[model samples]
Target chain A: MAPPTTPTLAPPDAPPPSTDLADAEPDTGRKRGLTGYLLLLPAAVWLALFFVVPFYSLAATSLYDPSGSDFRGYEMTYAFGNYVDAVQEYWTPLLRALAYGAAATLICLVLGYVLAYAIAFRAGRWKNLMLVLVIAPFFTSFLLRTLSWKLILADDGYVVDTLQFLHLLGDDGRLLATPVAVVAGLAYNFLPFMVLPLYASIDKIDPRLIEASSDLYAHPAVGFLKVTWPLSLPGVVSGTLLTFIPAAGDYINAQLLGSPNQRVIGSVIQSQFTDAGDYPSAAALSMVLMVLIVALVLVYVRRAGTEELL
Target chain B: MSAARPAARGTRPPAGRWLREHLVLVLGLLVLLYTFVPIAVVVLMSFNEGTRNVYAFQSFTLDNWANVCEDQSMCDALWVSIRIGVLATLGATLLGTLAAFALVRHDFRGRSASNLLIFLPMAAPEIVLGSSLLALFVAAGFSGQLGFWTILIAHVMFCLSFVVVTVRSRLAGMDDSLEQAAMDLYATPAQTFWRVTLPLVFPGILGAALLSFSLSFDDFIVTNLNAGTELTFPMYVWGASQRGVPMQVNVIGTVMFVLSIAVVLVGELGSRRRSRALSR
Candidate 1:
């Protein structure tokens, strides 16, 4: 979905950098030497100031005394206990965010793998067209997309009415304002994240390898399990990370699609910062969430046998 | 409905084999359908004539599209989002393209560190990035000043990373021999760069700019924290959503989808024509 470079020429069909090529290039420390640092200076400075320094500020803000208010300026009492307080106060949402994100990532995996596999292998000349379709929805406002789900899964909506008629749902049961709705939104929104990486890895696999495995008298399923799955591990690793991280932090789905009871940590942190004006607790919650995600990602990448996440 | 199997060489194809062969593709289409359902709803709802402020598609009409700006607040919010998006895109594309060029075409110390910094913004959740930036602004005594400038800062900050990553990939994938060949013709470095390098790299830069705009436009989380009282389009949608969003929002949504798809398709077709011409 990226724009073409030249006005007269179309961009190549390479997916955005969010997908493949994570480990494509290494720094050779070669060529136009002096100008490199000059060119890099503006961005490097910008990131260090805005991106890096904000972390320091956030950590400091998180340590402010619990008694602090937005009106009466905060004091950094080094109240590391704020972290403990954050968990104690909002653990349900915290845990719910992680759980929902995990569930959505898994669903995205199953669906995205099939789509990616199909596009990579079965699409032939239509591969590029299908890839465009994968990212088409992403261009729309995410909030609008979630809002549509709110419409579709409403009490009187077709999906809900059908389910009720089929006896799959009770008379008063509804899909809107439910955890299922939230997870479904997450899965839909992040599906492209999963599909792109899977396509990248699966597309690179040699068709001959699968044929060779089949010729060796292995069953198709066995061939897939032994050869295809293992080869696609890197994409799986990257795709899951891309999907899970954003899904975990997303509040829009939980906010618009699910009820108040489905409030994830993102919602809590948002309200604390914007509505409650409780910067310290919010900062503390943000820190905890960041640390937890980082720790989880480290363990996941290590286990997934791919450290290409940088 | 079944096709003829190799009757002489093999037994009848197992049902399981047929299912297995097409299962993934079928499931994939279903998933694609699932994704499109909401988009379809967005389009259909744009034509909805629901008088109530609830989430149901009542009768159909083009009133929403015709009178989209009847809600002044929504239009104002859209304006805010567009302004922020355009400014952020320009700033990010300029800075990011330079950084991308440096990383891909030149050697430098702390290259890995810069790359990590670029990647970290993307890897970090929006909540974390937003809250942290808000903290920075608040701490710097800009608590009251958190609106357009602050939102712009946050937008550019997040967008810079993606911009860098996008342009970096394009630059990295580029063949340097073209520039070398240009220089071999005794062309000056500046002329070769302007004539050869910029045209080649411009696509990636344009792509980065487009991405940055969409991201900035659609962003709500960071903007919510840093925007203070100013409402962008997404923020307006979020606020209005609680009371059942207006159909005009759906109009915007449908337009966005159509416009982006049109842009992508034109680019695709143009590239196809160019490649065909090149082959000829």
Candidate 2:
């Protein structure tokens, strides 16, 4: 799905920055040293004013407390209890979020790798059509994307109906409101993220390497395990991290497809602010998510050897 | 049976190149169909004549579309959303480009810190980001109004990250020699940037702009949280979904889909044209 906030190149397959800078070089004339700096000022100021400031406020509020549970606009509370409460209340959801995210990431990697393999090394001439189709679901309204699962996995829907017909069912034969649907929705929503990056990474792989391996004693499978998989690890790492982080916190898929028990931390945090009016607790929950995401992302980047995520 | 035949042939022994290609083509088509089916179903239901569920077949009618648009409130909400999207795009692009430049071009004090800060908004969960921003605003004496300004500010704050990322990618890929060569020609920093850097990264900037527009247009989670009493298009649709959404929502959704596709295609085409021109 296009990012709801910035929708810029869908976050995962955005062309790396080096591509654009190469375009600006004139063959003959000299380039300005400070000009790039000068040109970049507006963007810097904008980020500082809007982004840096708001987050500072978010962090600051984590250290605060409202006078009461009722909307009192917060009187600062400098303690860790809020964090404790947030953790205690929502840790299960958070863990569920992480597990779902990891599952989605793994599924995306396996499926996307296969899809990308077909497009990059296998398909020719028809490659663009395949890509267009891969991206087609993303072009529609996201609500509908999630809503499709409701149709497919609904109690008497095709999936359930088929299960019963195949004697793989019971009277209850319901797939709706299950973790399976929730995870599947998240996976479907993000599979393209995995595919696009792997496509780019795998597309650049040289066929000569495969032939060279085959020319030796290596089998095609062995050659892929050695070269193709390892070379595409960057794409895998980035795609997994990209899908996992959002899936961990996603509320929509859970809300639309899963049962009440399947509520992720995202929905809970949303409730604290909107329905419960529990601002302090919400702030603390937000902070916890922030800290966890930062920690996990740092570890992933360290492993992936890239921190180019926007 | 024929459709099945192609796939079976594909996996057959020795798998001649033709069979292999046929297998991929068939599988690719299936995947595409899987992706397209949902939207197609929704579109189909929009025209279903009966008031019952979408799954059940009925005679076709355009009445749902007519009823969906007949509401004055829906129009107002859509207008609000469009205005908000337009404003958010403008604000995000203006700021995002600068942040991208700082991230890409300069190696200054706290640069890494700044980069991390800008990136957090994108990486963090939308709920976390929205609640934090909403809380921060209220904590700073913000009143309860999900009116235009609040939504615009929030939209820009979130959207800036994309612009920054988009512009930064273009900037990173850019060769420093271009700027150095411009300096060698005796042009000032501002002039070189205007003549060289801006032109080169123009496609990225434009892409970022459209990206921001679509994002702001489609957003629900943040807008829903922050939209005090005001209703943007997505928010309205989500709320209506709770009680069963109208058919016009489908129409609006279709329209938005077409427009966004055009925008993406146009951005790609524009950049292609520029590159070809530059190469020539």
**All candidates: TM-score:** 0.92, 0.84
Error of 2 at A149 (Å): 2.5
Candidate 1 reference-contact recovery: 0.68
Q: What shift in Å separates residue B235 of candidate 1 from its native position after superposition? A: 0.7
lDDT of model 2 at position A48: 67
Tens digit per residue, CA lDDT, model 2, A1-310: 1111211121222344333223333221222345445555665665566566767777777677644543555566685788887898788888888888888888888778778878776666657657766765675767766776777788877788889888887878677788888888888888877888788888888877876775675765798899888888777777777778777878888888889876888888888888988777777887788788879878878877765543
The whole-model C-alpha lDDT of candidate 2 against the native structure comes to 0.72
The Cα local distance difference test for each model comes to 0.85, 0.72
Candidate 1, superposed: residue stretches over 4 Å from native? A1-29, B1-20, B52-54
Query: Model 1, B197-268: lDDT tens per residue?
Result: 898887788879988999999998889999988889998988887776888888999999999999889878
Interface RMSD in angstroms for candidate 1: 6.1
